[model samples]
Target: MSKRDYYEVLGVERGAEERTIKKAYKKLAMKYHPDRTQGDKGMEEKFKEAQEAHEILTDSRKRAAYDQYGHAGVDPNRGGGHGQGADFGDIFGDVFGDIFGGGRGRQSRARQGSDLRYNLEMSLEEAVRGKDVEIRVPTLVECDICHGSGAKKGSSPTTCPTCKGNGQVQMRQGFFAVQQTCPTCSGKGKIISDPCTPCRGQGRVEKTKTLSVKVPAGVDTGDRIRLTGEGEAGESGAPAGDLYVQVNIREHEIFARDGNNLYCEVPLGFATAALGGEIEVPTLDGKVKLKISQETQTGKMFRLRGKGVKSVRSGSIGDLMCKVVIETPVNLSTKQREMLEEFDASLGGGKHRPKEQGFFDGVKKFFDDLTK
Candidate 1:
């Protein structure tokens, strides 16, 4: 027979939080506990079912896989086992430990610090050539005085006397054996009577730190550089999280970048466009000479091989594309204007202005078709 959904078995929503799932499972465990049932096989099976649901729902990786693939994801026989098989003693320790703040699994389940992101803006020149940058970040760091232990120098934490360091106390409520966090210790299992002065027993302190980050070449906007263990200090001295330096390239006045290629518009004189000549175009490296053919049209694109940005992924160089826009002469002298008018009249047969002639011809045909 097929199994029931874990969420349904626990009487909780699929998106229920860990604490809520734990609470629901605790209630079921209390109701169907074998100690209370006294050899009733039916209650034992129900108790096992609740244990299974609690185990799957509480684990992040197992929960994620179960959420996507159902029971097949966590089933060890089917090979989608992201779950570490639940143990009876360990599960009870967690049930009472985490739910009641017992801190029984503190050694094995120390939480990591939160990841952080810092946005860094760069110039095109700086991006093309990788550089090291200095940045200051405000975050939590392990207390220098306490060394993340929350205890005073030359002092150590002592085990709690209330629950005998089990972090929890078992109470007999009629037939039910109820487990709860030790009130005196607040579930820490240990106590730091003389706390660190700097961090005040928190084990971490807020401060600003300076760090140097090396940016790789050819990284575009939205690329990130990750520095491992550079984020805020972890709780109870666990491993720190990573810091992501997000890249945002400042807009360049001359060039636009596209996937290892650099693009720019070069202004061409009208005479230079009409007659073949060598002209200088700007590139990332420097200016390079480009030979323009006669009758070069505006918006003409020219590719300069191996003149663009180097690929960050492939270690290959790209090309630079120059687009030519013909610039009409302004503030012309009387003689220059006269010469241009004379030159314009000489091409009256319309052989030199193919685009202008074709536009007028198309307009004429459109009007004729409309009249018909």
Candidate 2:
């Protein structure tokens, strides 16, 4: 029986570009693949025809010949085969690799490894100032003994016999041909008759690798740093994956960070709040001097410029905000308690405390209005 035109089978014009032809074939292959249309003999036959059509159309030389003389131009018996076996591997790799997730497709087969994440715990000081840290990761590495070949010494992997090194086997149901991965070779298209003893025919081994990663200054919690090629090894000797170092800043004893700003509550003695004095404030680097103005109330804030964190991204420094909280004397001796009582008596019924005096005036007004 005479074969149908390759362009007609793929539903593309004869002048379609290689990319257009590939796109059309990929859609048809996905739609008519036996895995997708199981128990359907008619669709399976169309799938085979489509595959054969795509095989001829995608090749530059074969496409040229078929376009000029039709199927007779590339017939195997007419010496028009012109590397027909090579085309079968290309199609099998592209279609089934997607179905099984074993990494197929001519371009996608050599894909880089997957990215991995590592949560790193750090102190607030370390995150603000930045640090170089050494981390040990357990991952897969190429087997030294096998050199990533998965074969024993003095021997190499051979083409898979079950799939005839095409990595797929076609099943016939009546007039249909359905292609699937070869169970023997697992669709790798090659077989290791003599397996590597070290990697056990896998060509990779588990190893704990130590690496140094530099943490930039002012990296906050939830920030991530990408370390290139620091993840797991890829299959078939592909490139290694990336490693992401995630930052988790520990809670600070004295300060809380908000973006590049630092907030800290400075403990002030009652005397320091009452009488003007100088008090010491803590920063990430060292202690700084802060003035306590007379009659300074609790929750009063003071800004210390250029004394906060320097941002890693913006490179702009932020300010340190100091909030004053007056701490009452605790565990006082009898003499100290007597001194406080005398000081309280000197205030003369809250006359010297304007905030307390004004609060009582508002309270009296609120109740008088309620009564009216």
Candidate 3:
């Protein structure tokens, strides 16, 4: 007969959480444990069924394979047994008193630690030019005392009597038995008689670790720097996690950045706009000469090549674009006002201002056409 769906056998939905999956398996296993039934063949089959279901669903890797390919993905007969056989003792040792066999299985192995994120604030200058910074992060590290064993010196943990070191228990339901984590050793199989003073039986301690992070040049807001093996320590001496440094660049005083480009607005004197001349303009490297042409108007843009930022991902440099705004004379002296009035009188008053001359010409034509 084909095997039952693992989720259906455990009485859990496909999206059930880790804790929920464990609870459902525990309830079904208790209802079908062989020890609870006396010489009943039906109960024995149910108990075995629950055990098989628990074996596949509890493990993350096995569960993923089962989800994608069903029983064929995990069945040993189908040549999918790259993983060793799942031990009932490992699953139900804590609860069932090691009915299968009490011992630490190879299923529990050292794994990498979790990853962490730290938001780092930077000035626009630092982001453009790059900088090095130090950060302090609080995380769990392997305990120095007892060498992460959670035991007193010269004394090691012993196998849990209740689980017989199997760390799981068997629950018998109405017609089935299922295996689950034994509550005795909490699935560790070994019992710590004397807990470590530092970590308090966890084999790890919470401490702040100082780390130096190098921010690369041209990195902008929302960019990230990944620090490998800098996250929280894993359980049972597993591998560590990675730490991510998130970049948040502060607003600049005079410039706005868009990708690799830089933008700035510059104010020009009226005389300078009327007559072309060279003036010094500010750039990241230093000041550069920018020429304003005669009759230059407000909102005129000038592009300075290779003055903008280079992208972190792509090394392409960009241009710095400057928008010019003409400033009219303000708070003119009495003599200056009189001189301006004399100059205005000398204009011949009609066609000297080309813009004004064109406007009147168009106005005269409009009225003449309307009259016709």
Per-candidate clashes, comma-separated: 0, 0, 36
Cα error, candidate 1, residue 131 (Å): 0.5
Candidate 2 CA-lDDT value: 0.75
Q: Show the colliding residue pairs in model 2.
A: none
* Higher-lDDT candidate of 2 and 3: 2
TM-score for candidate 3, residues paired by index: 0.63
Clashes of 3: 36
Per residue, candidate 1 scores C-alpha lDDT tens digits across 1-372 of 346779899999755889999999999999999999998999999999999989999999988766544454565553222222222112211111122122234432235665555668899999989899999765567888888777889997788788878778899999999988778666657767887777666677767679999999988887989899887577567777677787878889999999989999999999899997999988877888999999999999999999999988898998999999999999999999999999999999767999999999999999999999
Q: Rank the candidates by TM-score, best first.
A: 1, 2, 3
What is the C-alpha RMSD, rounded to one decimal, of candidate 1?
A: 16.6
**Stretches of model 1 off by over 4 angstroms after superposition:** 1-109, 160-189
What lDDT does candidate 1 reach at residue 294? 97
> Per-residue alpha-carbon lDDT of model 2 for 157-190, expressed as tens digits?
8988888777788989899999877888767778
The segments of candidate 2 whose C-alpha lies over 4 angstroms from its true place after superposition are 1-111, 164-166, 170-179, 332-339, 349-351
Could you tell me how far off, in angstroms, the CA of residue 40 lies in candidate 3 after the best superposition?
A: 48
Residue 330 of model 3 has an lDDT of: 89
lDDT string, candidate 3, 64-176, tens digits: 76654345345554222122222222221111111112123323323344455566888888899898899987556777887767777787888889878887778899899
Question: Every model's Cα RMSD, please?
Answer: 16.6, 20.1, 18.0
* Residue 222, model 2, lDDT: 75
Pairs clashing in candidate 1?
none
Which candidate should be chosen as best, given lDDT against the real structure? 1
